[model samples]
Target: MNPIATKYIKLNTAIPGPRAQELLTRKEASVPRGPFTTAPTFVVKADGALLTDIDGNTFIDFAGAIGTMNAGHCPPQVVEALKQQVDQYIHTCFHVMMYEPYVQLAEKLNEITPGNHAKKTFFLNSGAEAVENAIKIARKYTGRKAVISFERGYHGRTLLAMSLTSKIKPYKYQFGPFAPEVYKMSYPYYYRTPEGMGPEQMDEYILQRFQDFFLGDVAPDDVAAVILEPVQGEGGFVVPSKRFVQGVKQICEQHGILLIADEVQTGFGRTGKMFAMEHFDVVPDLVVMSKSIAAGLPISAVTGRAEIMDSPNPGEIGGTYGGSPLGCVAALEVIKMMEEQNLPARGQQIGERTMQAFARFQHRFPQVGDIRGLGAMCALEIVKDKESKEPDKELTAQIVHACNRRGLVILSAGLYSNVIRILAPLVITDEQLEEGLAVLEGVLEELCL
Candidate 1:
């Protein structure tokens, strides 16, 4: 068995070791190739910021199940809550039976999510569902048809959500005849800002294009909502300035278009703040949330202004498992954990440290083209060269694969798939975080140097 010297990551064998290989064979037969997996090995256990494969290899989990474990895997309180909840009941179907946890979680989200305005929240099964429902509510409230989403923004995989998403390959390619009336707009990618334009100028240009779009493409009055990620997720963790975000909000207000904050990956303390929207000081009419909401539970929420949220008739929204009791209970505990432990501040610390390392990487490795993040949601944009600034998709994949093989779980993002993203758990110890970063650094040194 091959092993690496490390504190938390214990590489007992090659990534897909004997045991994992057997399971992989089975998985290949049973599971479709459509659903992608970052790590080749199957995880037997996970906790805090670490995961153990079936082969007994332990890995520091930087991916955090694609930002679904900000509170960390099997957080004690959340696990305990789920256990107690299971002991009481598992699925009563909130649609059929009224449950307190559902109402309790909704109340908690409304209170914690940005904006002091009277807000209401409803639960859903996934981020895509939340996006779909949020759009429905926006359209119902405004009686408008068209909706606008930004370039490189990722909403979800469902029809409407996929239509709203910007990425083409893997997500939208061959999945067409996408949802109609959904439009795309340019979101500022400052790193790749046009040849001569400055960041603020770029922002103004994109904002102005909205007016041009209204005249050339669709009327602003017909737009029900303009959805955006406060910090783009699959779009490479790209963060827009407060001016850019507020500009979008101003336009929405001017045209009577609802602003929907798709915080699926940026919410739940992942972005340092409780929600990324707080960074921009823009309160959205509708907020789409999932991922870290329930500490890995398959639960999502649409929290927004009470008036906008209540636009749909009573039975117009909701599903069989929309607000499962276990999800509600786990979410309640997750929020309590975030609050009592001050995870958002911890997330900020993670981002600071991560960006610091990334900055050093930029100086040391020419391929480390750009580094940007908000809170713990950090990323390194890989490029062929600093001058060319051409995306190095191959190198990014190699870095990710090398890191995973060496016992650090990581992920890739961006339209070009050249952004190495870090979504480490906030509860990770400094030593663990350092060790994980060290693994990544080592991979960069090996691959880029």
Candidate 2:
């Protein structure tokens, strides 16, 4: 039996209860307030699929640290492994003094990261670092200056990552002089298409938008790579169709541009497939990965064909705390847990159930303009007008707040901030999922009314 499931959260009162507020107050005094949160509430302890705040109020956790805990919080096996590693040692810098766990993780990633060819992995501290290294590798390997990322594709927050990321409000608002030469392209988001086109035609139009806005202007060969998210997380769970991915891959291949799948958010079995790229059958030259790779530790990786990953010379990429033995051990255990739990297949099942519930929601709520997903990663992009597909940002916020009030943690995303991204831990129980979904239904009914 699966051992990573949550027991239950006893809801004594509203979320962020009281003790959470105390911690929040403490945090405000101790830490900078900028990177804090737009989302309300605070957490104290999380185990499996449930979170108990400091005030003793328990809430069902659906955010799952932005989909970083695929195996659930403090899974016994992973926790045990971490404890054992803490006893042995913590940090020795994997690059300075080699560790078996790091090597073991690399070996596992090389074998599992969506390709049969000879592959390699470079570990880092976060998704941004992984993405930065990927861009560096692509540029070095191809000897090019320009990179092509998609609209609404979020890479990370570093200068280069922000440059690669497309949203501007807060992520790139004041951060200027972003790494120059990085360009944006069109991704296949079916909901917000320019009116009067079928799905296929819209996809082609976006493809043309790429070649026209990019290749028509800049020399394709000069572009080093095109980074993408298979099922965009923060940009709304926009699952680009198989054909759309194939079309983009063809364009990149034709232009001698390497495809960089930024599976940082969608990889590590969040999608039904191990890697989201597997759904499209397109093998990227470089795949940037992170998030749940180490269960919850701050570790990420860029895994790809040997040639590209090998382009960086010694001392070209690494960090002081990147891929510590603890993180590496956590990653190894995560992979083992996923395989044992058959998380990829389980993701499909969860997606099916979640989608069915969303279908019922759509039937009842006119605001639910679109419901899309790949696996446990699913979402509903609220719209003011069904035909116009205008973003109902206000309504989306209300829905989110309502969900939080009801003791179910939910998250919001999208370019216009109108999409609710549902990224629960894979270990959440059917009972807990149903409870959360019911709360979601109440929120939808309450807000959409």
Q: How many residue pairs of model 2 clash at the backbone?
A: 0
Best of the candidates, lDDT: 1
Query: How well is each residue in 122-202 modelled by candidate 1, as lDDT tens digits?
Result: 999999999999999999999999999999999999999999999999899999899999999999999999899999999
Clashes of each: 0, 0
For candidate 1, what is the lDDT?
A: 0.93
Inter-residue clash pairs, candidate 2: none
Cα RMSD, model 1:
1.4
lDDT of 1 at 297: 89
Quote the lDDT for 146 in model 1: 98
Q: What lDDT does candidate 2 reach at residue 257?
A: 91
* True-vs-predicted CA distance for residue 131, candidate 2, Å: 0.3
